[model samples]
Target chain A: MKRRTALKVAASAALTSVLTIGSAYGAEPIRFGAVAPKTGALAAGAAITHWPNIQLWVHQVNERGGLRMKDGSRRKVEIIEYDDRTNPGETIKAVERLATQDKVDFIVAPYSTGLNVAAAPVFAKLGYPQVAATAITDKIPELTQRYPSIFFALGSTTALASSVADVLAKMKAEGKIGNRIAMVNVADAFGIELAEASRPIFVKAGFEIVFNRSYPLGTQDLSPIVKGAKASNPDAFVAWSYPPDTFALTEQSKIEGLNVKAYYTAVATAFPAYGGKFGKSVEGHLGAGGVNTDTAEMKAYFAAHQKVTGKPADYWASAVTYASLQVLEQSIEAVGTDRKAVIEHISKSTFQTVMGPWKFVNQSIDKVWTVGQWQGGVFHGVASTGLPGAKPVIVKTGW
Target chain B: MTARETRTLILVVVAFALLACLPLLRHGYLLSLGVDIAMYTVLATSWALFSGPTHYISLATAAFYGIGAYVVAAGIGTLPYPALVALAGLAGAVAAALVGLATLRLSGVYFVIFTLGLAELVRQIVTWVQNNFTGSRGMYVLTSITERMIYWELLALAAAVFFIGWRVARSRLGFALRIIGNDETVAAHLGINSAACKLALFVISGAFAGMVGAIMAPRLSYIEPSIAFTSELSFQVVIMALLGGVHRLWGPLVGVIPFTILWEVIAARFPTQTVLLLGIAFLLIVYLIPNGVVGRIESALRAAQRRVSHA
Candidate 1:
C-alpha cells in the first residue's frame, strides 16, 4: 500500500514537471504564410527570387533563437506556404486559405505586380500588412487609398523609367550613344506601366523612340522583336521584360548581334545567372535593380545568403525581400505580435536590414534602387532618384 | 416511380442534403475547395451533356466561359449579379447557336479543329478589346457575399445542370442525340432533326458553362482576358469529363472531386514538379482505364454480378 502511494506521488510530480517544461519552452510557433508561384509559367523565377529568400530568412531567424517577444520569450517562425500557380484566382484562394484556414499570424506578399495587386484588397480586408517586395506600379496613390496596409518595397514605375532615361540621357550627352532608341515591353501590367512611364521620360530627355513594340506574355520567340529592333538601327535598346523574356531577349540579342551602346532589360537583369550566362558580355548591361555590394552589411549578407540558401542571392529583389522580413521581425519583436502595434511599428520605425537602414514613407518605398548595370560580373547601382552612392554609368560593350 | 428511379432520386436527394449542410461545418478551406470542385463539375458535366451525346469533341468551353467572365467584367456595377449570371448564360447560348449554325454540319476532326480555332479567335478578340477599349489590364469585381454563399450558388447551378441533364437524357431529344452519336447518317434517316438537336444541346451546354464563369468571377474578385480565356480551363474540363466517364451522369462529379484534391495536394507538396507529376499520373490513368474511373467501376461491378448469377 505504501509503495503504491509513493508511485502515485512520483507520477503526479512527473506530470507537473512536464507541464511546467512545456509551458516554459514549447510555445506555439508564430506562423508566417507565403503564396508564391511554385508551379506554372513563373516557377523558374519564383524558385530563384521568392521561395529561396523566404526559406533563408526563416532558417536564419530560427538559428538565432527565433524572434524575441516583448514578454521575454522567443518564438520560432513556422511558415505555411501555398503555390499560387501564377494565376490570380489561385492567388486569391491561397490567400484566403492562409488567412482563414491556416489562421496564420502574418502573410508575405506574392511574387509579381499583378498578383500583388490582386491580393492587396484581400490582405487589407483581412487586416494583414502586405509588404510587396517585387511589385512595381504607378497606382500608389490609389492603392494606398484603397488599402492602407499595402506597402510597396520595390521602386515605382515612374522611378524605374525616369532612372533609365537619365542614364540614357547622360550617355547621349557623353557621345557614348545616340538619341535614337528602340523600346519593347511585355504586354502585361508591369511592362505596360513601365513602357507608358518611360515613353514620355525618354521623349523629354531628347531621345527618339525609333522602334516601339509590345509583345504578349509567355511569348516564345523574341527573335522577331529583336530583329525588328536591330532593323531600326537604334543606338540603344530597352526591353521592359519579365524573367523568361529577359533571358530570351538577351540570348537573341547575342545571336543576332543587336548590340547597342546602351542595352537595358528589366526584371531579371540583376539576376546572378544573367552575369554568369553572358560572362564578359554582361558588363555594362543595364537592368531593373542594383545593389551596393561595397557595404560591410551587404558583404556579410551575400556570404550568409549563399551559406544559408546554398545559392547566391540575386542582385535585385533578394536583399529587398530579406529587408522586408527584417522589418516584419523587428516590428513583431518590438510590439509582440499585437498586429496593430506591428503595423504601427512598420510604418514608423527604421529597421537596419541587409539593404541598410530602411523605412516606409507614405506606404511606399521612399528610396528607389532603379537601374543597375553589370560591371565585371557584378551588378552595380548606376542611377537612382532617391538612393545615394550610385556608381557612374558605363557604356555597354558590343556583343 | 419504378424502384430504380425512386432509389436514384433518394440517393441524389440525400447527397444534396449532405452537401447543403457542408457550409455549416465552417471548414473554410473545404468550402473554398468545394466552390472550385462545383465549378469544375458544372463545366465537366455541361461539356459531357453536349459532347458526350453528340460525339462532337467541342473545345469551345473557354470561348463561352470567357464570354461570360467578360460580361460580368463589363457589367458588374450595371446590374445585379444574379441577373448578370442569367445574361451571361443568354450571351453564351446566343454565341453557341451562332457557332453551331455555322459549324454543326462539320464532322469528326473538322468539327474539333473548328471549335479549337473558335476558342483562340474569341480569346484574341477579348484580349484586343481589353487592351484598346478598356484601358485596364484587369477589372476588379465588387462582392460582399461570403464564400459559403458562392458555394451554395455553384452547388445549386450544378444541381440544376444535373436535373436538366436527367430530363434531357429521358426525353425524345436525348434518344435522337444518342442515335446521332452512334451513326449520324443512320440517325438522319430515322426522321430525327439532327442539326436542331445538336444545336440545342450545344446551346444548353454553353449556357451552363457561362453561368459557372459568371458566378466564379466575383469569387476571384478580379478578371482579366488571359485568366478568363485560358485554354487550360477548356482542356481541364474536357480531361475531367473524359476521366470521369462522359457517358454517366455522376461521372464528372466523381472525376472532378478526386482530381481537384489530387491537384491541390500534389501542387502544395511538390510545387516544382507538380506539372510533371500530374502529367505522369494522367497518362497512367488514361492508359490503364481507357473508359475512365466510373466506367471501369461499372464494368467491374457488372462483371461481379454476372459471375454471381452464373454461380
Candidate 2:
C-alpha cells in the first residue's frame, strides 16, 4: 500500500510540473477588444465601412506569425468582439466590460459619433489608445485637448463642412454648376451640426439656399420631403444624412425621380453598395471622402482589402480606420508597452499614416480641414489642393 | 430569520460574494461578465417592482433610467459623484410619480400605451436637451473612465437596488401591493388606495433605475438622445423580469444572471445570429416557461414534496 501511494504521489507531481511548464511555454496572447454595431440600423454601414479593415489587420498580423512583443517574442493577437446592437448605452457598457472586465491590451470602437463619444472617456481614463475608426466630429478634438490619450483617425468635420462650400465655389467658378442650392437635413445631432456648419460657408461662397428642411432623424419615408424638394426646383440637392437615412432618402429620391441637377449626401456616400444600388444614378453623386482613387498606396491597400474581405474597400471611414491602425502601430512601436508613454508620444509626435500625416495641432487648429466628392464612380479629393489626380468635377446646370 | 430564510440569505450572500471576487479572478474578462450581471441585476429588480406588485406595466422605465443618467452627466460639473447620483434618483422618482398620476387611471393595454407615450415623449425631450445643451454636437462628458471605480460603483448601486426590493417585500407595502395586484378595483374597495400605492411604487422603482443610470452614464462618459432613452431598453428590463418570474423575490437575479451570460455567449460566439436566437428564445420562454424558470422550479419542488409525504 505504501509503495502504491508513493507511486501515485510521484505521478501527480510529474503531471503538475508538466502542466506548469506547458503553461510557461505558451505565452499569453495579446487581446484586443472590438465593439461595433453588428446588428440594428447601424449594421449595414458597419458591414461595408467598419468591420473589414479590422479583419484585414488581424489576418495580416497573424499571417506574419502575430505581433512581436516586448520580450523579443511573438504572440498572436486575439480579438474579442461584441456587437453593440447600435445602441449607445449598450456600446458604452460593452466598451467598459471590454476594457475593465476583458482587460484587452487595446480596443477598436464602432463608427457612430455618439458611440465614440460614449467610449472616449472610458478609453482615455483607462489609458488605452483607442482607435475610434469612422466617427469624427468637432467635439473629439475638444475632448482630446482635455484628455490627450484619445486621438481621432478621421478628418475633422469643420474641414469637411467648410470644404464642401469651397468645392461648390470651385465648381461654380468653372461655370459647370447652377447658382441655386437647397438643403435637407436629418434632425439628429450629427446631421444638424454638419448642415449648420455647411450652410454659412455655402452662403458665403455665393450659393443661394432656396429651400431648407429638417426632418426627424428616424423618418423612414422621405418621399414627401423629396417631393417638396422637387417642387422647389433647386439645381443641387444637399442632404445631411445618417447611414440608414442616407439609403432611405437616396432610394426615395430616385423613386420620385427628383434627380434635379446634382445629387449629394453626407455619411455613407462612398459606400460600394450605394454605387451598385443606383449604378448610373450614383455615378455623379457627391459626398465627403478621405483618400483619392489614383494613389498607388491607396490602390494597393484597397486591392489587399478586396483580396482579404472579398468586398470592395473604398469608403472614407475605412481609410480613417486604416490610418488609425497605422497610427496605433506607430505609437506601439515608439512607446513599447507603456500606455501613458504611448499617449504622450501621440500627443507630442506627428505620425505618418495612410491619411498622409496627422499632427495634433493646437486644439484650436480648425483651418486644416479637408473634403472630397465622388465623380464617375470615383471620389475626387477636393480641398487641401496638393493631392495628385484631384481635378475638381464641376457640375453643370440643366436649368 | 427562520431556517428557510437563513438558507436563502446564505445563498444570496454567497452568490454576491462570488460576484465581488470576479474582478480579481484570473482574467479581466470575468470582471466584465460580473459588471454586465450587476447592471442587469439592478435593472431586473427595479423592473420587478411594478410588474410583480401592482401589475401596471411601466414601459417608461427606460425613459426614467435615461433621465437619471443624463442628469448625472449634466450635474457632474456641479455635484459630487455620490450626490449627483442621488439627485438623479430623486429626479427619476419625481418623474415617475408625476407620470403615474397621469396614467394610473388606465388599465391593461391602455396603461401600456400611456407608458409607451411617456417613453416617446422622454426620447423627444432628451433629443431637444442634447441639441440645446451641447450646441447640436452630441453631449459627451469630457472625462476619462476608470474601470475599477465604475465596477465598485456599479456593485454598490446593485446592492442598494436589491436592498430596496428586499425592504419593500418584507414591509407592509408588500401586502398592499399584493392586494392591488390581485385586482386594483377590489384593492381600492378594501381602502388600499391603489393610485397612491402605484405612485409610491413608481417613485421607488424609478429611483432604482435612475441610480443605475447615474452610475452607468459617468462610466460611458458620453450621453446622447438614443443612448439615454430607447424602447429596446424598456423591453430588455421587462424580458429580464419575466424570465426571472413575476411574483417571486429571487426571480430577477435568476433571470439576470443566465440571460446576461447567454447574451454574452451569443454575441461572442455567433455574432450575427444572436438577435434572431434571442427572439426565438424569448418566444420559447413565453410559451414554455410562462411563470419563469424559477417559478416552475419552485412548483415542481412543492409537488415532489407532496408526493414524498403521501408515500
lDDT of each: 0.85, 0.74
Candidate 1 Cα deviation (angstroms), residue A11? 30
TM-score of each: 0.85, 0.82
Residue-wise C-alpha lDDT for candidate 2, range A1-399, written one tens digit per residue: 999999999999999996675465366656778888888767877887778888987887778776675566766667878888987656756776777667777787566676777766656656777656666677755776775566665656777777777777777787766778878888776777888788888988899998888778778788888888888887788888877778898888878777565677887777777766766666556776746666677787788899999998765777668767766666765666577876777667777755566665542222232555556666656554344455556452221
Interface RMSD for every prediction, one decimal? Answer: 3.1, 3.4
What candidate 1 gets wrong by more than 4 Å, as runs, is A1-28, A96-103, A121-127, A147-149, A169-178, A204-206, A216-221, B1-26, B74-87, B94-125, B128-146, B222-226, B267-273, B287-311
List DockQ for all candidates: 0.30, 0.39
Which residue pairs in model 1 clash with each other?
none
Judge candidate 2 at residue B213 and give its lDDT. Answer: 83
Candidate 1, residues B1-311: lDDT per residue as tens digits? 79999999999989988998888987766777888898899999999999987879989998898888878878997898889999999989998999999999998899889988887788767655544445443366656666788889889998899999999999999999999999999998999999999999999999988888788777665565667777878878888888898898888888898889888787666655777888887897789877888999999999999999999
How good is the docking of model 2, by CAPRI class? acceptable
Tens digit of per-residue lDDT, candidate 2, span B1-311? 78997997788788677767765654545555666678777877877877788777778877888888888777777768789888988988888888888888788899888887787788776665544444465455554445555677778777777777788888888888999898877888888888887788788888888887887776566676666787787888888888888787668888888888888777766666779989987898789888887889999999999999999
Q: Judging by lDDT against the true structure, name the best candidate.
A: 1
